[model samples]
Target: MMNKGRLYGVGVGPGDPELITLKALRLLRSCPVVAYQSADDKESIARGIVAEYLPGNQIEVQYHLPRALDPYAAQPIYDEVVIPIQEHLAAGRDVVVLCEGDPLFYGSFMYVFTRLSDHFETEVVPGVSSPMGCASALAVPLSYRNDVFSVLPAPLPAEVLEAQLLNADAAVIIKLRRHFTKVRDVLHKLGLASRARYIERGTMANQRVVSLDDMDPSQVPYFSMILVPSKSHL
Candidate 1:
């Protein structure tokens, strides 16, 4: 019997290819197969990030995980998409599943990781997450000593977001594509609008930093973020 191949879930960083770690780059290039997920109609963001570095000899596999679905309803589809990666692993071909940010941090790679890690040898490489990337681009300090930090998904109810904001010293409001206006209103109501920096495609080549009021809610993209920095200063 052939030995099974090792599985790698490598975080490619928020958007910048430069942010990929040395270890991740090594594993990514050495792997016999490279994989990432995207919609049938869209190009893979993860693949685009590292397209320059690929040796062009590795077998590339692209899977599709639809945007915004009921996870329960999407489970079967998710399960189905990962079968190709599993087949490569079973054939003793090492597969590197590329993720946008940290693989386990609300990453789509989690779908593959959860499915394949149990059956094969697995490894995960950490990368720069969105909060950190956005904060750097904004040049704002996120948290001070003992300051609480919160990651609030914009999909949550306004009341719930408000309550969470009231408790944390700093926060990053994400998943704001369709919920930008709601999050903007909450920030204004909570008097955090001034401190909240709105950026779209943060750290990407076409990155845009716009004021909260200036943002066109309808034009918001999936990669946008709102960074609320801590008020405390040393």
Candidate 2:
């Protein structure tokens, strides 16, 4: 008879390897099986961060989960991607799933957890999230007394973006790479452009933190985020 296997959903922090939590590092070192999502690429930030911590010759699995443009076409992705990983856990192998930022926040690990937790003993190890890294890299306070903050993605409708920007004292907009120009225009229209600081690959080797006025959309990467704080509230 074999003991039941447990799953550890590990957050690797934003980009810096040193930011990984002690608990997360421990799991990576002890766990015999490791997994991380690539979506389409072979290399992943989450996987790279923990590679140093993992013991040599450990079984490592990388899932290239589909990122289909249409939700309807992605159902097969869910089935094919998660089923095999679940099987590995059921075989009594401790598995660690690597995620960038907090595992539960906008992370693909959530998808796996939701699918397999009913049968496995699952745990989540929190990491330093991206918003904190971005703010610290910019050397700015995220909020002042009584200031409300909103964190939203760039794909949100322009009208909604406008409303949130108008009301929130401080805001962090993620997923800004493709929508950089539009987001920039909205910030400028609301007279908050000067206060907006864009951080690209925050805390990473090629990290770039600059004012929105100086950024060119073409130069921004998908990992970029913009932090805008209202002057009136600050």
Candidate 3:
């Protein structure tokens, strides 16, 4: 029987190439096969972050997962990606899946990990998440002295988003593209709008950090996030 190869789910960090962990870089250089999620346009932010480390002649697998919010629509794409990955593992070739942030933190790597772990040896390497990167970019303390931090995905219904924002000590609203208007409305309703700061493409070269009040809401990008500190802390 041939030996099976291992699958490594590696987080390359939020955006900055310097943010990638040394372990992730090492694996990217050494892994025979590299997999990453790209858009229909074939652009991959995760791959761009670690592009410098990818060795020449390395096998690149680009999974063009949809950029939409519907997970149901993404299932078939995930299933398609699994086939090539399985083939690599069966052939005893180690595979490295590039993730934009911490693999399990709202990252598509979780889907791949769950699907492949039962059949293959898998490992995860952690990296700096977007919230951390955004906080650093804004020079704001995320949480301190028993402050509860909430990381909410903006796709949630307005009521749920409002309820969570009301309960949170410090909150980070992620995935703010199409949901930007709704999230901004929820923040305004909670009286937290004035306290919110928006960070777009955190840690990237063209990053933008501004007061949420100044933003148009509808004009924000998918990579944008909002940070709201607790009233007590303000």
Which 10-residue window of candidate 2 scores lowest in summed lDDT? Answer: 66-75
TM-score of 2: 0.93
**Which RMSD values do the candidates have, in order?**
0.8, 1.8, 1.8
lDDT of 1 by residue, 1-234 (tens): 999999999999989889889998999889999999888888999999899889999999999988689989999998999999999999999999999989999999988999999999999999899899999988999999998999999999999999999999999999999999999999999999999999988889999999999989999999999999999977
Which pairs clash inside model 2? none
In order, what lDDT does every prediction score? 0.93, 0.84, 0.88
In order of lDDT, best first, we have: 1, 3, 2
Score every model by TM-score: 0.98, 0.93, 0.93
Segments of candidate 3 deviating more than 4 angstroms = 67-77, 231-234
Candidate closer to the true structure by lDDT (higher is better), 1 or 2: 1
> Which prediction has the highest lDDT against the true structure?
1
Q: TM-score winner among the candidates?
A: 1
Q: What is the C-alpha local distance difference test score of candidate 2? A: 0.84
